[model samples]
Each structure stands twice: as C-alpha cells, then as structure tokens.
Target: MSESTTPLVWLVIRKDDNGNRYRIGSYATKAEAQQIADRLDDRGPKQLYWVERAGQGGAQ
Candidate 1:
C-alpha cells in the first residue's frame, strides 16, 4: 500500500429524508465549502455539511 499525505478535501453532501447522502463536491478548504453551502441557501431545504478526512487540516 502507498502512503497518502495529501490533505483530504472538504466534502459537501445533501441528505435525503430516507437518510441517503448525495455527494455534491469537495473542496480543498473549509471556507470554500462553506461558501458553496451559503450560496445554496435559496435552493431548498437540504441537509448540508462540511466533511473532512482524518489528518486533514480544517476547522473541527
């Protein structure tokens, strides 16, 4: 196996009523992801979140 040191990106997902998560996109920074979520304010009722992998540099 190969070691991956590259930081994991921030993932934006939309959750459905059935508890299904749909991936939207991933960003290298939390700010970028939050910006997207903010822009989606007028879209509809959505379960939005910023997810980062372990060892990734981002706000906890």
Candidate 2:
C-alpha cells in the first residue's frame, strides 16, 4: 500500500502475516504506539499486536 493509504505514524509491531492480535492496546498517537511497543518487547513472548490506525475511519 502507498504512504497515502498508510498514515505517516501508525502502530507497528512484530506480528504475523495477518493482523492476528494477542496483547494490550488503545494507543492513540505515535508516541503511545512506541511506548507500548517498548513495554511489550521487554515483557517478551512476542504477543500479537493491536494497532488501530487512527484517522482512517470515524463518524463526523
């Protein structure tokens, strides 16, 4: 997908091919995303990611 479709800042993680989740979430910003990534990484087990790309969908 192009960068347009993909937001400049998004939830990135070490997940499987498909969006298979298996951990904590609710990150609303780039900083929050990075914070969660680091926290989870230290905890180990490579829990599935829960990255909800903000700004893509919402009710006006």
Candidate 3:
C-alpha cells in the first residue's frame, strides 16, 4: 500500500483551567506555531503540537 503525502501542520492548542481545549490556529511549520504560543505565554497555560493530517482534506 502507498502512503499519503499530506503535509503536516503545527497547531496551537490552548486549554483553560476547565480543561477545555481550543484550536487557535494552524501554521505551516512548528516554529511558527511556537512563536504564537510564546506570545500567548503570559495569557495562560497552553500546549503546542505538530500533527499529521490524514488523506487530502481529511477531517480533524
């Protein structure tokens, strides 16, 4: 079987004290997402990640 070549993206995930997660935005690279997370560092606690999507236009 052949694998897909879908490009990966970096997502900025923000979780509040209530444990609710929000997908703020998607970036082309991990560094780009990290920059946004750094800026929001003072706002609250959050997590950064690089996720590989499924086939073209696959659902999250």
Best candidate (score: TM-score): 3
Per-candidate TM equals 0.57, 0.38, 0.58
Deviating ranges (above 4 Å) for candidate 1: 1-8, 45-60
Residue 34 Cα positional deviation in candidate 1, in Å, after optimal superposition: 0.7
Can you write out model 2's per-residue Cα lDDT over 1-60, one digit (the tens) per residue?
Answer: 664564445554456546454334444467777777777677756555444455443221
Mark the regions of model 3 whose C-alpha exceeds 4 Å error after superposition: 1-8, 44-60
Global lDDT of each candidate: 0.61, 0.54, 0.56
Please identify which of the two predictions, 1 or 2, would achieve the higher TM-score against the true structure: 1
Clashes of each: 0, 0, 0
Cα lDDT tens digits for candidate 3, 1-60: 223443446676665666565667776667777777678875534443223322223233
How would you encode candidate 1's per-residue C-alpha lDDT over 1-60 as one tens digit per residue?
Answer: 233654546766656778666667776677777777677744767555455543454343
Candidate order by lDDT, decreasing, is 1, 3, 2
Better of 1 and 3 by lDDT: 1
**What is candidate 3's CA lDDT for residue 41?**
71
Highest-lDDT candidate: 1
Give the clash total for candidate 2: 0
Least accurate 10 contiguous residues by lDDT in model 1: 51-60
